[model samples]
Target: MSHVHVPALASFLLAAGAAFGQAPIVGDIEGKEFRPFPIAVTELRLAPGAEAHKSAAQQLVKIVRADLELTGAFKVLDPKSFIDTDGLTQSTVRFPDWLNVGAAGLAKAQLKDEGSKLVVELHGFEVASAKEGLTKTVSGSKDDVRGLGHALADEIYRYFTGEPGVFRTRIAFVRKVQGEKHVFVTGIDGQGGGQVTKGGGLNLLPSFAPDGKSLVFTSYRLDNPDLYELALGDGSLKRVSSRPGLNTGGRISPDGGKIALTLSQDGNSEIYLLDRGGGLLKRLTSSWGIDTSPAWSPDGANIAFVSSRAGNPQLYVMGSSGGEPKRLTFQGTYNQTPAYSPRGTHLAFTARDERNVFDIFVLDLRTQKVARVTQDQGNNEEPSFAPNGRMLVFSTTRSGARQLVVSNLDGTKQTVITTGGEHSSPSWGPFVK
Candidate 1:
């Protein structure tokens, strides 16, 4: 909020007192009352005598603040409330200054553009303990300085939350341009958005491999619905399944050993398992009704899918090896696009509420309770979880266009990830391995 200038300092001093405190960031958060941790992010300083990448420095801190706020667990204090802007050295930082502003945690960094890379020395502090929790130097190409900032945010997040952060992961979605749809990939924050497919046909349902190196989707390039895998490294396309009739709804397993998809070649749509190379491994569902949109659990022991067996499309979970299916949704007549969280506690999907409005909902697997993620917003659907399962990506029509939206798991906070395009069928990719 304020543009107070801070001199460059070598070391940061953290002060701890009992005046301000925050809830511990550990333990199970499911079904708990939401409480945001108060944190303050200081403007990053430029290293001594280093060429000032002013824009990069500002963007880096901005992104770090955004990444934390987007989690819905952090409340970033306004910069105007900061009382200490002087050079923060190990002995100069005053705990009372930050605690006065109601900040339980503080994050600071120094940026240096060293020709080939942008180097950053980042630090995290606890106000109550008056101690630094994280101090690390991270570097990245000048072209990807935002990534460096995200990496820093991840470290701070892990330091407090003891869990992995999703800032470095990516999301895949369908971006429509002039009636042509192509798969597009973007960072979790919507940076680096680029078309992954350039063919002259429709491409949809872009699902990433567990390794995050390739995307598998259904395409109409050959004038028939078929499955194809696109190598993200070299932009190479390989046809995975071109069987006669219908081939769609392809989802790769967590172990990368199999793919679960829908095949209507037998005059009836059913869920089927295929080897990584498209060979039919087994039939997962032989229901009389349409069964599609299969998603694998993190352990690869179960598959959550959509089925119309109960005379209405609903969510169902069955063993990956194929067995009696158990319905997982009863509150909605229409529930599809089930995405099991990697944390193994929730299943996010699109459900039509009683008002016939499509919204995103997350089912607590442990509690067997359904929580709505989107409400009163124009048709929000196709929920996909970030790698850490703390966030989700979906398409919303609330802004008058089918745009991509990123939100915390409960949907209390949301941010649009795309603008000026009709994007849908979003799938968050795994962390880069």
Candidate 2:
């Protein structure tokens, strides 16, 4: 396969505001080498002298603190280690008082009732300037306090990290147990691994829609790995496409109104972008090559993917609206599954070297240079950047079996997130709120 050269006219970039504020921004990446942030959080106060539900308020504080910690971007100051401020609220925080505890950021929230709904108000502030960073309210049924707390966490995440928070997003991945494989969607930290497919031959490769209400993934529910769309939340199901020979790759657009996937129904594996309602938007690749792993840009103007159009699999950039493609990577001989960062200046993918060891790599879209994030001797692939573009979650073989791993995008501070089971095809969810 040879590199496809696309024309420059089709290479238009989206506005920064769109990328900076966009939700569900998807791209490929693993560990970032950047520095981590440290912060503290405290329980919101019940009304003055109102002590009917102090425990519930305390639960909300713990949930908020844990949600931020799960992002891998923030290091929450341990509540046990800090002096207690159990009854603090959004209205009563003295900026200097909290700062003296050595926290760079602070989180304070309150629980209230607006008619029949339970409303949780959260505040994120910078310690130095005492300036409020972000504030938002979440409303839910009285029993849904946990949901409300997670929503507040999303607001706090957006406050410090300009991108949408995955606090409310759902992660879909393949889980294998007792020689059986199933696809699942759970909280960002693998908490909600709800099985989407069962009794599998191999249910791998799960991708959620931009709305996080649905998921499109490859499943062996039919005894052969085929593409299926499973509506989430209520778990309604639909079969998106099941081509004759292959149905293993599918990705939804950022707008939640389209899909780009690889299909062999046309007699060869090729990339196709389809509308939300199942209309063909465009055929991206028409070749005999194995053209899979299609990831749409935030603006939906182009796609970053891995194609074996060249003799060896490599990362390539092509017009999302249908035009010639351009090679985005040239350093590696085996680069598969190229995902464009939401910021459009970076790409994350899996690359193999002469020794046949695969590692996660991020490419600087502007300088056209490559940086390896996983230096361990084992195999690391399938890197998906967080919505903030600062960290990525990927699968690593370092844990003796394939398991989930997270780290800063710069390749430092690596943390193996999953303990048991064969977990692969890890897709970090979008801002949950």
Cα RMSD for candidates in order: 8.0, 5.9
Off by over 4 Å in 1: 1-32, 86-89
Model 2 Cα lDDT, one tens digit per residue, 1-433: 1222222101211233245664311121123223347688876756543365577688778778777766556778876656544334445567666666777788776767565666666767777776675677767776766776777777776667555556666667787877878776676655545777755477778887877777788777776657777777777767776657776678888888788888787878888887765566777787667888998887878888777887878788888876788988777678887777766777888888767888887777776766677775489988887765666788889968888877665555577767777889988777654
What C-alpha lDDT does candidate 2 achieve relative to the native structure?
0.70
TM-score of each: 0.91, 0.80
Candidate 2 residue 116 Cα shift, in angstroms, is: 6.5
Deviation in Å, model 2, residue 356 alpha carbon: 3.0
Model 2: lDDT of residue 409: 58
C-alpha lDDT (0 to 100) for residue 331 of candidate 1: 81
lDDT of 1: 0.81
Best by lDDT: 1
